[model samples]
Target: MDMKTTSLPLSDQLLEAIEERIVTGAYPPGTRLDEVDLAKVFEVSRTPIREALIRLETMRIIEKVPRKGWVVTPISPQSLCEMFEFISELEALCGLFAARRATPFQIQQLLSAHEACRDVDDPDAYYRANEGFHKALYAAAGNSYLLEQLTEMQRRARPYRRLQLRAPERIKASFAEHEAIVAAVLARDEGAAAERLREHVMLQGDRFNRLLQSLEGFGRAGR
Candidate 1:
């Protein structure tokens, strides 16, 4: 796979910012997204905001009604479960392939990114570094199509995953999971890497229940 990239355009930048807000519950379910107000907030014209809204609609993060304009899509518990289930499988594939195929250079890069995560005290910094660690795994998988699909799913799930970071002791646990995954990859143990990755990616068992409770609390607070 080619390792080329481009910076996000103004519209995409706005889309990510707005999406983050939506995921973080700043603009909870049913919140109206006014294009003109967004344009003013971002100091950009309506064209970019319009484009961003269109992309959000495509992601099912928002929807337009006949006369109600665009509103944040409500996330049901079932939908959240389904999203994480898909993400878990996708990332498991990435880890499996990466363990079987990663080059020495790629392994070193993954370690570096993991180390960066360990060094960050701020949640945002850790989040960015965590992203780098996962992207390295995707790149190491050596499949362009899988990388593209996984990237999109990851982007869509970013907010929920970010919320997980706020859970008690989650950062430390996440880093430990990353360590295990990195070790599995370096050892060329495909099954171990895949299983570890799945567990790490999925909000299952206790984690899933906790997140559901938190979301419920957030919904009540918003009302």
Candidate 2:
């Protein structure tokens, strides 16, 4: 029995289970994902399997094909770098605008979102709160177009960002980084805010190495 089959909603449970298989290498890149087979393996209805696969598809971790219903996407280090580079530029602009235009209420909401992360030990829970904080920044920026772009990019980066949180003390470090970003925004330092936001998305030095190590470890952990 899957240990994750409890309390969480049916769709969430299914998504978590399926994504775990992919990350753990049980469903490696190019591995076909059959709905009926998955339904039987998890002892669930096809409805939930379809729902879970659709969500994974949005993450760009899996895709549908002509004959193969779905297969894991081949992710590469270069591709990850390219995605982050684009995301960093988007985030930097949002942070810069937020620092300049955020109202008192929006700033308060941003702080609330960051507070939501404190004491959160679970990687998934932390990731959700972390995502909220980013969304709060976008909302503060008040740019509908940029918000739309970042929203999709954020979705693509979700799984990797969550996995990155699994690194030792990474969650704590992430929180502190968030604090610095918030501080810069509150100070209304546009350049500082942009730089910090860019740095957050584009991990450097030890942080980048940690993400790489985490990815390697994830592959090794797969069945």
Q: TM-score for every candidate vs. truth?
A: 0.84, 0.92
RMSD of each: 5.2, 2.0
The lDDT, on a scale of 0 to 1, for candidate 2 is 0.88
Per-residue lDDT tens digits for candidate 2, residues 160-201, read 787788888989988998999999999999999999999988
Alpha carbon lDDT of each predicted model? 0.84, 0.88
Worst 10 residues of 2 by lDDT: 1-10
Model 1, range 99-214, lDDT digits (tens) per residue? 99999999989988889899565555577789999999998999999998888888677767777777888889999999999999999999999999999998888899888877
Worst 10 residues of 1 by lDDT: 1-10
lDDT score, residue 23, model 1?
Answer: 68
Model 2 clash pairs? 24-222
Candidate 1: deviation at residue 205, Å?
A: 2.0
